[model samples]
Target: MPIRTEIVSQDRIVYQGDADMVVLPGIDGVMGILPNHSPVLTALQYGIITVRLKGEEYYFTVAGGFVEVQPDQVTVLADAAENVAEIDVARAEAAKTRAEEMLKEGIPSDQDRYLMIQAALRRSTLRIDAVRRYQQGRRSRG
Candidate 1:
């Protein structure tokens, strides 16, 4: 059986198609969905979302969102979302370095800035993980 999945952000629809399974980063924890799943809705936290279709896999980094699962469909609406192919490795690396520097500074007096930096770190790390996995696949094929 095939399950329909869609990933949407505030500004755009990042992905939409058929999938065999989906692993989502939920607020409470990670959740997996397959065809004919019971309907449910849950808040999302900053993390990665993985979708499997046929024999292929796809990955996306999402910064918070809500997921709704119906009998045959899964929809994720995120504050922001990016796929591995869409990620800029250089930008993600820079953000990771900047976040590390901010953390080393002891978070200072700005709580919001600290949290923002932390979120950036998480997002960047997710991207890096996905990209690295893709690179590994390329290496094996080469």
Candidate 2:
């Protein structure tokens, strides 16, 4: 049986569909959810989320989030999420560069702002890498 999966970011639902299996970047490590899996509620780290159906696979980049897994459904509530195919490489690159420049100037007095920049840097890097790995046909199982 396929598992129903939904990935939602703050602004919108990034994906909603049935998948053969879903792989998540759990805080403990990667976790794979299949139909009839045990229930779980876990925090997610900055990484990739993969959904497979039949022989096809879909990849998404998630910056941070939480996932709820039930016997037949998986729900991801993300801070930011996007399909690998939809990632704007140029924009990611630009963000990365900007972040790097900011970091080079030294940490901001506001620790929160520094942390946000760091998170942004990580997210942009993840997006760029996901596009390079998945969109370029280097599809290894996530």
Candidate 3:
């Protein structure tokens, strides 16, 4: 039996489907969920969420969130999420560059603002890496 997986951002559902396996980037580490997985709720980190259906894999970049897993379903409520295929490589690159510059210039005095900037850097870096992996996978298949 496939597990129903839904990923949602503040505005809309990023993805909703049935998958044989789902891997999430938990705050502590990566967690893998399969059908009949035990129920648990955990905070997510800025990283990747991978869904496998049949023999194919789908990748999504998530910038922090929370994930809940039950016997029959898995739900991810993300601060922001984007499918690798939908990501604009150039835009992500630009964001990464800007983030690096901000970090290098100096840390902000406000702890919260500094943390937010760090999170942005992490998210942009993850997006770029995800896009690279997606492109590599496509090239290998093609």
Candidate 4:
């Protein structure tokens, strides 16, 4: 039996499918969930989420989120999330650069602005890394 997995960001549902396994970046560490797994509710860290079905896998970059796992379903409510295949590497690199530049220019007077920039840096970095680590093979194959 496959688990029903849904990954939803603030704006829309990024992915909804049945998977043999789901790996999440939990706050404490990475956790893998399979069908008929015990229930869990946890905060997620900024990292990659992996969904495996059959012999294939799909990857997504998630920037902070909450995951609820039940015996037959896993739902992710992410602050921001995107499929690695959909990511624009150049765009992510540019955003990472902008965030780094802002930080190097000196901390912002507004704390919220600083946090926002940091968050952007984290998200962009996660997206870039996810693509590098997971999307390359798919691209080469295609």
lDDT of each: 0.84, 0.90, 0.86, 0.90
Off by over 4 Å in 3: 138-142
Error of 3 at 140 (Å): 17
Backbone atom clashes (below 3 Å) for every candidate: 0, 0, 0, 0
Give residue 94's lDDT in candidate 4 (0 to 100): 100
lDDT of 4: 0.90
Worst 10 residues of 3 by lDDT: 133-142
Clashes counted in candidate 2 amount to: 0
lDDT, candidate 3, 28-97, per-residue tens: 9999999999999999988888888888888888988899999999999999998887788889888888
Candidate 4: stretches off by over 4 Å: 137-142
TM, every model: 0.83, 0.94, 0.88, 0.94
TM-score of 4: 0.94
Collision pairs in model 2: none
Candidate 3 structure, TM-score to reference: 0.88
Give lDDT tens digits, candidate 2, residues 42-113.
999999999998988889889888999999999999999988878789999999999999999999999999
The residue-by-residue lDDT of candidate 1 on 84-134, one tens digit each, is 667889998998999998899787688788778888888888778768876
Off by over 4 Å in 2: 137-142
